[model samples]
Target: MSRRSVSTRGVKWPIVSAVGLHGGMDVLELRAEADAILAELVGAPGGSARLREDQWQAVAALVEERRRALVVQRTGWGKSAVYFVATALLRRRGSGPTVIVSPLLALMRNQVEAAARAGIRAHTINSANPEEWESIHEEVERGETDVLLVSPERLNAVDFREQVLPKLAATTGLLVVDEAHCISDWGHDFRPDYRRLRAMLAELPAGVPVLATTATANARVTADVAEQLGTGGGEALVLRGPLDRESLRLGVVRLPDAAHRLGWLAEHLDDLQGSGIVYALTVAAAEEATAFLRQRGFRVASYTGRTENADRLQAEADLQQNRVKALIATSALGMGFDKPDLGFVVHLGSPSSPIAYYQQVGRAGRGVEHADVLLLPGKEDEAIWRYFADTAFPPEARVRETLSALAGAGRPLSVPALEAVVDLRRTRLETMLKVLDVDGAVKRVKGGWISTGEQWVYDSERYAWVARQRAAEQQAMRDYVSTTQCRMEFLRRQLDDEGAVPCGRCDNCAGPWVDSDVSAETLTGAVKELDRPGVEIEPRRMWPTGMPALGIDLKGRISAKEQCSTGRALGRLSDIGWGNRLRPLLAENAPDGPVPDDVLQAAVAVLADWARSPGGWAPDVPDASARPVGVVAVPSVTRPQLVGSLAEGIAAVGRLPFLGTLTYGGPGGAHAARRSNSAQRLRGLFGAFTVSEELAGALARSPGPVLLVDDYTDSGWTLAVAARLLRQAGAQQVLPLVLAAAG
Candidate 1:
């Protein structure tokens, strides 16, 4: 309760070395006081808490010098400790609550608990707790809260930004940006919401110390983030330490294919020290890996963006409490998930970049003395990486189109309305708009987005540079899996870490510490699990809103009468099993050929299984229509022979008649609708499909459902519209069957 809690003259803080021993008496006193406060923050008594030199340097910069600092240290370096100690010291000096712009809910939960241990009253306003927002805001307003954590996305929220942010900026004792690298576009996980931090930084009063910390930033990202932190015109203190984890024993076991990778995990996952994460490249892969692991009797759960918030929370808790062996996860579980004693991190496929891989693996070997880090690189890694690469900064033409649309609208248009005019998908479109908003080209208002009349030029050169850098990083990951150099050094060099050197512990440095062999029995089981095809294709239940504005007749929900029944696909194109085969067969430039015998046989197997499934076919459900009476193909602009042959083969196999194909007459035909958002796609295929007279007569005469066949399904809207046509032509039901699903 001393008035001079933080040393104004940088004096009286407890010293751990001779340098502090030589300081003035006041310096000694200040050091002592700091040591005591650190003890209290760490839930220890009698100055038991100690700070590392780098940690002390950051704390001193913020408390003693009242300066902004960007600490780009590795994870488990006590970045949170520096901020919590600073907040306590500043609060004792009569400063207000520290406002932390955190990036993830998991991180927030951890911070809140950590703060409570230090007797700091911390609360968060995120998507999880709407009911508590009012009470939390009241507490913040009444100065009852010591630390306030808000997600980056909350910065642009209409109410929060307008009402609460300005006040917090004016009076906050400290401004902390956790996971700060997210603010830089050059960073691997750049988020548009993080860009809003620039606005927050601009609004902070002079002399309010700011701290931004991130564990995975490369040198370029570090410099960019430091530059952004200089919003008040003063240079930021950059406390960057060497990126190395002594406890991590890194190794790469290059597996031949998906089955081997899964088999390796099943065989060796339990042997690796403790509970950890099993990273997958895609949601489909994560689910598949989770199922396969469970079948092998490993307790696990799948975590992905598609998982509900409640389920994600439960999964994180499960891992923290060691109730599950691991969380088979996609990138959604990547950043900000903290567990000090996580014992292992195994990747089913190599991440595209060394930096990203380092970030994911850093979660382990944190508190434990020794942890296993393994990379089981797969053949499909590069393709998945390219799929993500395509979503980066849109082309110049697309940018111009967006600006033009906003400028011409004379009013704000929500994302859906914008999609009607722009061809970009919803995610990419929203990302572009956020970037534009941050660049002052547009502004988010009450209704939607509006042009700010700012002349914007697309930075083609910068984006191209980023693209090249991505390609180079991908190559570096490829090298990491195949190289003989120290795995740690290879990753460190990718981050431009000055201390990059051989760790003498990786497989290359230690003669393969991890076993790469998988038992034949395990491999066979894995192959069966993967090769066992058939994924349920859930039909689109509702039409996208605002279709009328785009000159499409569809709106609101599609009555169950016109909707296609829940269908089935052999597999997802992103899956590890049939995905490999389907990728080549469904490639953009793949030849127009008849369905391969293996794939045709697989399709027939799917149908046979579907018929026996409960609630499937005529008598399975009392109210449901009977089994498919005929087969009809949807003409494919790119693969007519494939669709035609598949339909004929299905009819020939099931002993059903082969109805004629649906004619395609729209501009560019079926090929033009290859990639589009729901609204745009609906517009593209609204009138493109029509049932021929012969098919109409066949459907009218048919007493049972028709097996609607297609080469592939992307949006499922094509099947929906086609089903409507068939049902209108008197078909009982339209059971959609496709070769692959576009997840």
Candidate 2:
């Protein structure tokens, strides 16, 4: 279809009017009206704030023709603007409020604010605002809201899907899917929640125009997303643009190790152009980097999935206002965070894929003329990638097992209940359930999941291809870090950008613009900071819900008297310092041995510091009974020597009795419980450990708290169980102390 530009009311709007029309308004008149609405939405007057040709085409397809469209453009290419403009134009036509399936809270917040600026009222119903959902739903029903933003995860919520979604789908004027690439398993970030959109799309009224947008989709992902958008045989218009950002000056700084990389950031972070992001591979790494940077006098905050919602919002605000030099973060802070003047992005470790890397770096240089994008690849990166790689879709056997369990249950089974029957972890089981739900193999009801009894064939080949893709992407990331070619060109090529060319701004095209040299003093300080270990071990206060259904005798909150007190660990297994020192000692093949002298010394120091701190076990109690009277070791099948030595060493250092080891009753008990869910772990260890007469006498003699030591703590159930036994055996208190915590 061709368009004719038309002028209207002192404003120049692109109007495409057709002769011998298709029973619709003149294309030109529709375009003029859309243009006027776009101008007003962007807070510009007259001819200003005009929509780009591609943007206008997508908008026209959605509004004028009432068609489905997918727009794959780079970050900051105004994808949100296209949807907002369409919402305004469609609302003026007396259509119902636009329903936008946004991917993140940050994105929703940004969209709501941007829509308000454009004079389009919008509200969000997400996990963060459960209290506001009822009122928001009322507003939507009242026809008072212009746009309603709901997270994809909300699409599967029983009440929302059954109650609000049908109404919204039947009456929605326009449907928008932000970060639409997530719909495809082939996409860099495949969210099963997004897959539920297929059902949502199929449920929508035939004429309800749909819009899907993303910045990181490649050829495969683009096709997949476009296909998903084509529900009910509606052809979706795919509008893709070049994926190059000339403003990003890309470079890779190869550091020798985690310390060097951390030290380099600590030394040169301020020298970077402006405040930006420091991405880490894990939550522990983020916290470590944030702590080290703060010690180095740079105001910074840690942002990760673990960060509280309020803290995350504040961290975003801090970065936006330039209060903090950076926010050391995980992938949680990457997508949908809009900061126009973001000046730099530095990775502490390489992500698994170049596409993921490119997407993250896209956060920078969005509005500025130039922004720095540096990758400080670490030796530990590949291991971290491998750790995350386990999240891949499980084998067919496991999928079949889950389906069979649900089918046999005859009723809805919660994820925890499924976990009791399936060997998968909680996260993996939940993800599998979601994928199954999307595939129609299962349904999520109010109670939990019930098998739909659908014949679900596992796409083994597709999963294999995805696994291979992950490996290839990991190798590509390696290539990107070591490539002599232009970094920007390399990233663009990975995204299938045809216009991939050296931008003469990267270190390969030009020369390194950042300083990699770190002073000895700074390096030493970084090492010291990382080596200073002592992370609080917050005990599990409440038992998991629905445990009785899993054949476990546990429910509701664990009584305070029966709980293990908040304790300490030498360090997180993910820590930059002790993590390196502890990994080998705790490896699967690692021989059972005594605690190394250095590690033992460090553990002693941590204990000393913990005992003297203001928040110590008996801070200011002056009860003389504050100190731990004895040290009890949890028996370790794999590391008995290590556990025994650690307890003995602590007792000797603190001049306390060394309570004998807790006895293991079976050949394969807690040792076999690794990687299992809580219910399985609890069952495996219920009476596996016995309080020996010797240890019982030691505990009885020491009515005060006794230090319960273990080689490592994973589920914390082991410690909890041991602590409960010790308490039941007449110990006044149980203080858990572990060498490492698997976070």
Candidate 3:
């Protein structure tokens, strides 16, 4: 049977081909035709307002529901266009007006400009005066306003209650609440005013249909919406899914401090020329960092809540257009914004929480290729967060303030206006808001403002809870800093919400742990050594009194392994399978001087296990020593035969030299990095001579030196592994040329 092939053309190709590669003429014509309408809505709406496949389905759902159906979306995916298109569908119906509750003035203006450009009659209500608002009201009354957007600050006014909601309620219109996740405290953005949204909808007599959308909301937020809006269980059509995008290469880089980290960023940034974002903890730092980077010739922009709307727009536009190579921002850049083709996202410090970090890092790599998200390690990030929490955040006082603010407004007020009236600085207010947001005290709306819910005094309320949680996480971070596990694996575990093991995507998984363990063990003996009665304990441990045994726990001491009284006793007990039988056996059968055969066998097994395990860690044990076992010297990679051989060895394991974010030592591990991710590919490329005498001809000696030279070393794991394998294979001496002994 013959099968038919698909034809390249399927429709009115001329009309359908609106855009294609390289700025095709058809796309330019379509944009020209769309310019007028889009320009008007430019400032009126700010979101990922582009058309998408699922949005088409939503447009169909809204029509099917008769009233607009609610749309709940995750972040980094455009949710704004779902409503824009639904309203466009409304225009075709010519029956109802569409009203949007936006909390950002810049966003409202942006959407308005876009609509005006698109030839759509878009208008905004004025928060400054009733008179100006009446004009917009009149247009809505005439049914000429296809889309009427209002900041919640404007909508919460008594004047608006008496005029606008009544008219909008009576008219056949669609009510869209963008950034709907603000309704719950579980979200990063929360607004108390958004809680009263259902009640306000009830105030509208014609039953204005409600539609909500957000970039992210876990299951609780989704469930809360149904409960809050009386949509009933499953009444709201849920289309939630994983926020993952395959194109994104999510990773974080941690350092001991900010100074060196920033230096590291500057070093690698030469090739990363497209737009990117750097998130800092404070507004000042954001500005300072941007200026510093800019002085260094990086085309950078900075944004915080303090940045003027005009400046913010220009900065965002500059980033989107690649005019600015990078933007130093805070949480201000997280939601309802899109700047495609970003090459990197540099976190000036570690994120306050995994959620914030995940969201911020998720921003990069949205383009066709891989991108980076780096988190500089240290206390600066944590200290700034704590200062405000400890200083101005009296939880109860904040709760009272929020409750009072909510009560005074009577109607819901936008977050910005509330922030304006609050007595504290922006950071304090934000902390209060995050608390209120979590406790369902307020809700968030698109454009970064928040809304309050019901009246409630906050006495050590949200602040206390958030602060406590932050503190616990901070302790975990401290523990991580002091830990001996591979740094990359620890980072991976810290970021995993489900407590999964290291992802192998990190440096630890990539093999850094090998060098750390081996080097550390070499300093401490591999066997336990009993001290003479008055010999004194190891200095690494604090000189605690009691003149106890070496195995006893002592404060201020660090060793190959921590030995607490209880743990030592438990270990001793476990060794004999039980206390009674083991005590007698150890007393009667102490090996007469020479080491026992079983102990020797155990050490061999442990060594074998360490060789095979990922990041294997072993404490110094008693008594087995080696005679500088067969050494295998690795030559410099510049030697074609050596480079080919090394390449051959790495490729044998199906790995490859990954050029981005990973390398093996030599001037930043240049040669080793060259063979990183593509190890497998190179192995195939050198199939004939993989580890052949052609590469090891010099290792023909009885204890040869296998010195592999490279420019730099992050950790000496790669060379160590090669050295170990060659030594095991009977090459005399195995020493890494780059593994310099302790300074």
In candidate 3, what are the lDDT values of residues 229-301, reduced to their tens digit?
A: 5442125665554444444434445554344444555555565536688887766456555655665577878
Ranked by lDDT, the better of candidates 1 and 3 is 1
Sort by lDDT, top down from the best: 1, 2, 3
Best lDDT among the predictions, by candidate number = 1
The window of 10 residues in a row where model 3 has the poorest summed lDDT is 529-538
Cα TM-score of candidate 3: 0.51
Model 2, C-alpha of 412: deviation from truth (Å)? 2.2
Clashes of 2: 4
For candidate 2, lDDT tens digit of each residue in 94-131?
Answer: 88999999878898887788788778999999999999
Q: Candidate 2: which stretches are off by over 4 Å?
A: 1-32, 546-552, 618-625
lDDT of 1: 0.85
Q: Mark the regions of model 1 whose C-alpha exceeds 4 Å error after superposition.
A: 1-22, 25-27, 40-43, 617-622
Cα RMSD, each candidate? 4.1, 3.8, 24.9
Clash count of each predicted structure: 12, 4, 110
Write the residue-wise lDDT of candidate 1 on 47-88 in tens digits: 445665567778778887889999988877778888988898
